[model samples]
Target: MSRGFKKFSKNSYKFFLLIYKTYKLTKKFHEFDRIFKKLYNLLNFVVFSVFLGVGYGKYCIK
Candidate 1:
């Protein structure tokens, strides 16, 4: 009975550790995703502004 209790405790400790590690990884991924989204938006805005400027230049020249 004592042996079984020791094994159970060990397994529970490992399970909790696994859960904690997974939570930390997910948190990091969320942070990376937020930063990536911001960078993507900034890139899109830059591209859009460049195209708008080119189009306006063409209109003015014509």
Candidate 2:
């Protein structure tokens, strides 16, 4: 019985460690995803503004 309990405890500890590591990795992935999305939005906005400026300039010239 003591040996069985020790084995069980060791397995449980390993399982908990795996879960903790997975949680940390997923958290980091979410943070990176958020940063990437923000950067993508900013890039889109800059490109749109540049296009608008060119269009307006062309209209003014005409």
Candidate 3:
């Protein structure tokens, strides 16, 4: 008997939700120019931060 949460799907449900939200927002809104731009910038920052953090950790460990 196991405990805690189990992610049985290859793609977690949250990923699906994120994809759906992004798709819907982009498809439905033409005037959400600034909002979409800000969201894109925020996503870029998160991705860059993850890469930078991992690279710095590897350098420190070596």
Candidate 4:
């Protein structure tokens, strides 16, 4: 192979590696996002319930 073609091939391989890594990282972030959303929703529900119970208890006492 000519020197120019060899250099081009090497650069191409590096670019492919970069693209593959980006795809893997994106997938990982998506999974993390789903988990985070689930936890956030659960926490929100707990907080809402606490507030609601407190409000009802105070109303009943008065």
TM-score of each: 0.52, 0.52, 0.49, 0.52
TM-score of 3: 0.49
lDDT tens per residue, model 4, 1-62: 34765577578657755755675577667775666557656855775687678778888988
Query: How big is the positional error of residue 60 in model 3, measured in Å on the Cα after superposition?
Result: 0.5
lDDT of 3 at 59: 82
Q: Where does model 3 exceed 4 Å of error?
A: 1-30
lDDT of each: 0.66, 0.66, 0.59, 0.66
Off by over 4 Å in 1: 1-28
* Candidate 3: residue 39 lDDT (0-100): 74
Those runs of model 4 whose alpha carbons end farther than 4 Å from true positions after fitting are: 1-27
lDDT of 4 at 27: 65
- In Å, residue 4's CA in model 2 sits off its true spot by 70
Residues forming the 10-long window of minimal summed lDDT in candidate 1: 1-10
The TM-score between candidate 1 and the true structure equals 0.52
Tens digits of lDDT, candidate 2, 1-62: 44765577578657755755675577667775666557656855775687678778888988
The positional error of residue 29 in candidate 2, measured at the CA in angstroms, is 1.4
Residue runs of model 2 more than 4 Å from their true location after superposition: 1-28
